[model samples]
Target: MTTSRTYEDLVKEAVDASVDGWDFSWFEGRATEERPPWGYARSMAERLAVASAALDVQTGGGEVLASAPSLPPLTAATEGWPPNVAKATALLHPRGAVVVASPEDASLPFAEGAFDLVTSRHPVRTYWPEIARVLRPGGTYFSQQVGPASAVEVVEYFLGPQPPEVRDARDPERARARAEEAGLEVTGLQEARLRMEFHDIGAVVHFLRKVIWMVPDFTVDRYEPQLRSLHARIESEGPFVAYSTRFLIEARKPGR
Candidate 1:
């Protein structure tokens, strides 16, 4: 990587860039992250091929669901963000899937036991009970979630060291417990820690901007000092490295 580019140029480009939808195409050359081995999209598509009715929760731009080569006869997806709702609708409607405008925290808009398959990818938050409620007996719920301490390297660099509870808020075990409590049987669960790299400060900026929850109040003005220092470090050190944790979980509703 070259260090000749000024920090001002990189950060401004990222800051002004659009972060709409779930697409991360803008970071093609600026950053990179190792993908999990489970091949979440392929796996979800395989299950979708066999399902009779399916619903995708927190379907950000319907990207993952839209990637499926086949969908059940009755397919639908829910997204809370208006921009994402529009994006998802535009993508999924042509494929015979209805996109619903629903908040992540609100109850699912469908009737009970309406879907035989439920899927989500990197949801802001998983509503276990709601998922179970919408799933039919013997239905399956599959999701790829951000695991505990995901991308904490960047969090710590931007802010500071976080408490144990805050860092472990998204633990897989907690998710397992919640699913069990919701009357679902855990079928499979796996976790992975993958390498992440930022070639420049702009990638970091664009990342934080896209994934707002990572740093709730991330603004270049507020973190300019830290950004400048990190940018310098990257210029000298080649690229900044971080590890992001992810988990794949599958659970089933028990019944005949």
Candidate 2:
């Protein structure tokens, strides 16, 4: 007869697993998330094909950039976390990309107008001035960013309701304004709300571990009561439901 694992067993498994890179393969069957319709990777790849020099900021493990079918002559990626920096270096070096270890919130290290194109996927925080500084005149900045109130359902489930300010932290309009302030014109902007489901408590644990910004200081011991309650809910319900908000933004520096 088959045996079902206990909630503790599942949570422990997730906690012990390595979340080294940006890879989410471990959640294959345990969780599901709907992707945006624009196909960000494909769009970025198309832009990459035509650019002569490009930079990918906050590149976690270089997974997205490395996946491009072709890279520009001079391609570089910046990573904040050390583990991810090493991981990205390993993954991108062979592909003719340089991985720079940069501070999470520090100014970018490149010289002024160094790249013809700049891209980022879900950057922790957008540095509009820095982006403009690093891009040549007429250069484009393309990115898919986390929108306001993204995955708040899961967040509130663990931490209770949050203030409006916290909920609207990543507003797309604010991003547009910032880009404009930095002398870049916003050419395209689109937002989407996608579905997310967690089939088991372990999936939740893994997600929290990987995406540290979700809970900030999430811990199994500290939130055991809430975790247990959520475990019971998942046991009864088919799956826990949440929504992920994403926004695609394209900005350009003036002058051809």
Candidate 3:
């Protein structure tokens, strides 16, 4: 059986990997913060208030359902987020929240035209059509996502060499087009670029350990020696430069 580390150990190990004591206040502080522009929640509630049903697409930790008041019998469908939804269901006591953890790419549990509105946060590209399929015509689809430039290339550069393809959400325009193809009207779209600062290379490493949202299959094990070697080089060469990221995307489905 696989063993799990204590929360304290987990944190410490993550820090040790980074080696450099860095300021991580931003990530640490917002560790539990929901994605911004809560317009999607408001829109979901508004639409569900009118329609009979709604779905929280790939509900993570059930944060959206918990925060939105009196949502119309919010039903959640997670393609592969079993543990997440299980924990989320405990916190967000919607009237009915079903968990369907499917390994195969498929539509959420509901039938076609099942919900009048659908919402997702940082949804993978593979699921876009599924989101459109399950929503009723005139139903809105809302989502927020990490952009392509979301710390992947930089992290790879620092870590040395690259692993297999990491799963990613499509760029905003492509996602919007997919929504349109699915027969939903695109209404709202926004992007925000934030330059997150890391104090030093160690801070970057700590960020990776603690908050690395990269794919689950991603591993630094094979490259650990190289990373250590690079660290030594940086130490000898002088201060390592720090950088940040570009704007990620957000979009909304318009009501009929």
lDDT on C-alpha atoms for all candidate structures: 0.94, 0.95, 0.53
**Candidate 1 regions with alpha-carbon error over 4 angstroms:** none
Q: For residue 212, what is the lDDT in candidate 1?
A: 95
lDDT of predicted model 2: 0.95
Candidate structures ordered by lDDT, highest first:
2, 1, 3
The Cα error of candidate 2 at residue 83, in Å, is 0.4
Better of 1 and 2 by lDDT: 2
User: Tens digit of lDDT per residue, candidate 3, span 145-181?
Assistant: 6654565544665544454434234366766677677
Residue-level lDDT of model 2, residues 1-256, one tens digit each, is 1117788899999999999888999999899999999999999999999999999999998999999999999999999899999999999999999999999799999999999999999999999999999999999999999999999999999888999999999999999999999999999999999999999899999999999989998999989998888888888877899999999999999988
Q: Which lDDT tens digits does candidate 1 get at residues 42-89?
A: 999999999999999999898889999999999999999999999999
Per-model TM-score, in order, reads 0.98, 0.98, 0.65
The candidate scoring highest on lDDT is 2
Instruction: Give the C-alpha lDDT of model 3.
Output: 0.53
lDDT for position 57 in model 3: 59
